[model samples]
Target: MSKKLNMSRRDFLRLTGMSSIAAGVYTIPGVGGVLAQDEREVTIFFWDGPPLIGIREKALAPFDDAYPGCKLNFTSVPGGPASGYNDKLFTSLAAGIPPDVFIIEIGLLPQFLADDLLLDLKPYVDADDYDLSQFPDLAIEAYTHEGGIYGMPDNVASIAIFYNADLFEEAGAMMPTAQWDDPEWTVDDFFSSCEKLTKRDGNRTTQYACDVTGWDKVWQTWVRIFGGQLVDDPFYPTECTLNEAGAVEGLQFYADLRWEHGFAPRPEAMAMGTTALLQTGQLAMFYSGSWAFPNFREVDFNVALGHYPAGPGGRANYVYYYPLVVPKTTEAPECAWNLLKFFNGPAMETIIREGGLQGTSFAEQEKWFVTDPLPPANKHVMLDAARHFVAPDPVLTNFGEITQIMQAQIDLLMIGEERDAKVVCDEIVRQVNPLIKEGQWRSG
Candidate 1:
């Protein structure tokens, strides 16, 4: 581990000119580097969240080796308010001692942008020799608010349907395809297939055809298949378009998997551990994101990947990508920018390859669809899913709140509490409309 310099609030404040009392006095203890001439030190604040994999020792080594004399300091912090890290960050920023750079999910970008806490990185992209074309378009679009770019593309989390190949083979069903225009399976085809593979011992279902949770991916995918946007527009995020005909049909389809069709895991059985159920062959299929891919890979049974089943609208997916950002409070914006560019550039490709992580870099995007290290049958599913993928509503700053309502409404529909699709859609619209209207909408 490299030696890290101690950065004090008073020292940074003095250097940044927050205190006007001491004018033209460039004498601050322990300030250095590109920003300052004489041995100045730059301290950066980094999130202690699971997402910031680069902050780890092995991942940070290459950057430190490349950029000698530059020092990076990190403070460990949890991810959420429930973990009290949010409060810690608030207090630090309020005291003008926030980290130089922090991690913000692309989903949460609207909130930080509205608050004016993030530094615009459009100039940095233009100034450097960095290849902006190397980053994934979806990742770029996610962080680009209005006309400005706020962050570099980090790792992306995308959803893919995980299925048991043994089950499919036994049921004599063909695997799902990644071809968007001509998907191998439809929504009804998927349900019926799952239903066929499911095993029942008495009244209780011994094996579930699918495990559908109240997660964002499933809901968004449903809306996409039914030809409805999660919001009215793609560029500017807005209200619960879930009330729309297509969206309601999607939601109902999701709910009906358990209640109407009995092809999914029962509400009570879901908490018994989905991973275990899948591994034990009790669940034939699981709808989840790529982040959970590693977990399922270790199972003894053979696993396969498939695109989300097609509905009336053909094929669609709920795409998720995270963008990296530099906070406005950082002491070394230029150095931070350099580091940001380096990671998004080819230098990070080495890390991605070594880490065995699924990413959405431009170079890798077109190739993933054809890769066959996964289950032999559904080779091109992931890259195929990217097309016709619907992003989360980009306008609303309150993702947490909106997801809460989405989950709640879906839960009600799943449990048979809400049978009328239009009524549920109307209720979702009523709950979400006001929140969307009040938020600062992002521009196309």
Candidate 2:
């Protein structure tokens, strides 16, 4: 392993001056990289909860047989980067005992690459003649930095509408189309259904139409679908473009769902939880990624998938994925590499089929995901959405800070504190542009 450089918080602040702070300062005092080099044990870490934890273990059981004499040590934390998982990983890195393999959100790729923590998998792929064409372009695109494949995504959790068929039927509202390119599945058509699905009891909503989650990707999809964009370019954003007329209009339309149209529930009612509401028939339509399946499967009602409504820019929605990586610091490189292959191969199948996750590989997705005879019987919906997906915001190392700035402003609109999307969009452009510029600044 090469020498790892430690950057202090002060150093990070001074060096970048952007709102970037690592989970732990690399300068923290600990034996940086002195793990036993002879250990045959390969450690893998994950961040998820519930049945997923159990399913992952079941999927991994074949590893021992796949690679004889390799001991596996696996641990999965409850949440994501904000959920003590980052703290634990960073602590392990500081002590030079980080897991050999781990899965992470795609957003964290830039930071990991910047810290020189992730191993470049190009050599392994080239040596073994590994076929990278199986996975979707975005899955590979998310983890490939400067042509070196640093990660392989276990699944692509593409954004799509998961609606309650029972609620739609009860209200006599037309159901959303499973096809992403369907011309009839427009926002106007969607809202028409929403209005029908909405029921009220003197200002109190007995049943709601649609509650579009204010996740950065979810709202941003509306921006693109409305023929607007958050940045000048998705791959290499030069400045914020969300203040444009289309972007503003798109955001305002969604905000209108709650405040103006009285379709979506208020924050108080939503606090009861979308999953619970959808399960109990209080909500007809809600937007979430394919990962929502496991939690939603518990629902007794009939839940089906719907693609994002088409708009001026066509059905442009976002997709995010979890990529498994082998850290450069792993002592057991061969075992870890084999483990990574296993993750992308067999483990990928189990994770998608049994775990209810959308697959990263397109063929695997069609064969496994599409064929699954489960609720949301229209399994092809997510696959279609993924095919017609929009490129996400530029993979900037400072993306977290950029999103933080955006969310802080956009929240006002979603919460009805600000009636005008233009105000929030303008504020985001003002705040996020420099951070986008800082991507080049950091690279320079």
Candidate 3:
């Protein structure tokens, strides 16, 4: 009384127009076990930058060859110096026209997740048995929440001290170790080198030892080195811990670089910003992320990479990555997932290699990165530093607001509007804790 069903591989392939055996095995709805012949168009949203240029020029061609049936429609959004991109993205989402895939910075992931904006990628990842072991642990950990993987990392980067070799040689200061575990390369060593490199003309400094331009996140690394935390826990921050003794000391040390040591630049003193200053040989050293590599290569000065100074808490730096995320409302989740895998996977490797992206997230790519003929000839320093990176506050969804509140107090201290580090830390705790509590209460 049972009916016999028969289907050949060729018959299935002909029915679905699928190019792969795997595609034929996985069923698409309404087609039984056959893949659909209809071409799927996936829209991707990403920030417009130099790297995007490389991606389009180098990565896209290979991706097309690999998956001809899937069409990629890219939309470049503006970033940096303003915050319009997020607004635009939110508007698109509200209008029910959100891009299938988009880039989400690690700091913004919590906010996006809290709003239920991202699709859980766990199902796709598990179905394929994707070898996530190829990526750095920190990179994977950043996008994971509540047993769900929301995205895959596009690139990974961390903060490091970039120094001018000419200045260091002229000052007779010992160069910082490129090795993370170099015992002698401590905070004291960093300060000592800065002291020696600083050049002053009477009351005016001709050349500063360092530029503390973007110290908001940089300062957190220092706090960790000094055995302190900006909050009770970076991932699940319930209360501000900047008022702790170690944190106060770390902040005090940072403030001292400008107000006390007279080596680091003050806001008014930096006219052309860190890039120009470093290029012109006016600034000896500055703390910045690996994104500076491309621009630094264009300059005429001799630049080398140095590790973030080790501290009592052991070596520490903030690790960050922008993940390629799929929105929950995507019309073609399967096609979007395919695009995400291809773009962040092997097809994108050539783009990353040629683009001079220093901190690639893939383990296999690390060898290529280190061997590439690039400045900071000691490129291995970044890989070493990655071993000790600290993930940022995970539970705090209101990063933008909290950062603004904390920065305001820090700015007051930096500009002499406030003097005492302890007082400033106390003020930050008083102001930011309420915001966190309010957010938690509302969510609850």
The local distance difference test score of each candidate is 0.67, 0.79, 0.74
Return the top candidate by lDDT. Answer: 2
Q: Candidate 1 — worst ten consecutive residues by lDDT sum?
A: 23-32
Give the better candidate number (1 or 2) by TM-score: 2
Q: Score residue 279 of candidate 3 by CA lDDT.
A: 82
Relative to the true structure, candidate 2 has a C-alpha RMSD (angstroms) of 11.3
Summarize candidate 3's per-residue lDDT along 105-131 as a digit string, tens digits.
666778788888889999999999988
**Candidate 2 deviant stretches above 4 angstroms:** 1-39, 294-301, 441-444
Q: What is the overall TM-score of model 2 with all chains considered together?
A: 0.85
Ranking of candidates on lDDT, top first: 2, 3, 1
What would the C-alpha RMSD of candidate 1 be, to one decimal place? 7.1
Q: Candidate 3 has which clashing residue pairs, if any?
A: 234-393, 235-394, 235-395
What C-alpha RMSD separates each model from the true structure?
A: 7.1, 11.3, 8.6
lDDT of 2 by residue, 262-317 (tens): 89888777787887788888888888877777766566878898887888777777
Question: What is the Å distance of residue 219 in model 2 from its true position?
Answer: 0.8
